[model samples]
Target: MTGWDISPAGVQSVVSNVRDAADAMNSGITLYGKSVEGAMTSAGTLSFGTDGVGGDAAGLVALALAKFVEGTERDMAFLPLRASNSANGAVEATNAYISGSLEQAWNAQRQATRAPDVTAFLEAARKKAGEGR
Candidate 1:
């Protein structure tokens, strides 16, 4: 027969690591946003002349930078929430594992299979961190 062994302490450790990662990511994102807040506008104003090719080039550059920043922000927005949800799920599974009951095991499996509510987790984290963003 094949079986699995799980340590609650190990799972708890993973949960702590994940939460720490989420917090770090949140801090980094906040810092990055602040640092580049007006970069797009600054870049756009680097035009050389009213009808010069440099103006068009500067506009294109600004647009590209804006898009890049937007994409980066969008891609990173949910990462912290994902990490938090994963940590929460790990804790739930660890509890179920410790209970050693068939029903709890099934519940854990269900929880694992469900999609994480990242938006809610993000909101909670932001609130906990005393951040309006």
Candidate 2:
């Protein structure tokens, strides 16, 4: 078995690291949300009409702006949702890792404290009891 630094301090450090990563993830989420908000605001501010010279060029510019706004709005709407999903996934994975590590440490400690021949001893005791019956 690989050596493990399965002390209380070690576990606490791991948990703290996970929390730090989560804090970073939260900050990233906030930033992504702000970006989405900015994109939406920009899309809202886009003018879809003539730009002084009302001609084919103006129409093309307007069309391009409309398309840009549509794409920006759609992308912005989904950006936060995707970032939220990614953050949630990170938290879930972290929780799972912590839980599994702690559980394995606990199990290892329990095993270390148990006699290697405990099962054999129990079987012998059961056989003796059966013989007495």
Candidate 3:
């Protein structure tokens, strides 16, 4: 089922990415020969809002990232690796294809959204599950 079960880090990453991209796009106004004043007048301060360049870019970027998360999540979510790949001696290629997709998602999210501190959290969680200290 669908849900809004996103971590705070995820939300932050997404917002931060969108903000940064908006800044980059706004900066590009100079390349097209648009003066700061002209660009502002044309593009306006919408990039920082929810209905401007920032918003549109964020939506597009997020949708693509979600697909990445799904691909990796689903692939890893399954049991064993055989079911996910062919026996053409391409295990590495298969794993990479899956992981690379995740990497791309991660990159995009960093650009358009936030990501969780999964490594730290998981490491700590594993430690907790180990023999009592």
Best by TM-score: 1
Question: Over the stretch 23-131, how does candidate 1's per-residue lDDT look in tens digits?
Answer: 9998998887766756755666555767786554446666787788866754577677567666777677667767776467557656765666756665776798896
lDDT string for model 3 (50-133, tens) is: 655455233444445556554554233221222222121123323333454544433443332233344555467569879575
Error at 126, model 1, angstroms: 12
lDDT of each: 0.70, 0.50, 0.40
Error of model 1, residue 61, in angstroms: 4.2
By TM-score, the better pick of 1 and 2 is 1
- Residue runs of model 3 more than 4 Å from their true location after superposition: 34-133
- Going through the candidates in the order shown, the clash numbers are 0, 0, 5
Best by lDDT: 1
What CA RMSD would you report for each candidate?
Answer: 5.8, 22.3, 21.5
TM-scores across all candidates? 0.62, 0.33, 0.24
Provide the global lDDT of candidate 1 against the true structure.
Answer: 0.70
Q: After superposition, how far is residue 81 of candidate 1 from its true place, in Å?
A: 2.2
Q: Which one wins by TM-score: 1 or 3?
A: 1
The ten-residue window of minimal lDDT in model 3 covers 79-88
- Give a tens-digit lDDT track for model 2, residues 1-133: 2443434455556556656665676577568657655655454333344785433333444455657755654444444343443444444444444566645544544443433343454467569989998
Off by over 4 Å in 1: 44-62, 113-133
The positional error of residue 132 in candidate 3, measured at the CA in angstroms, is 68
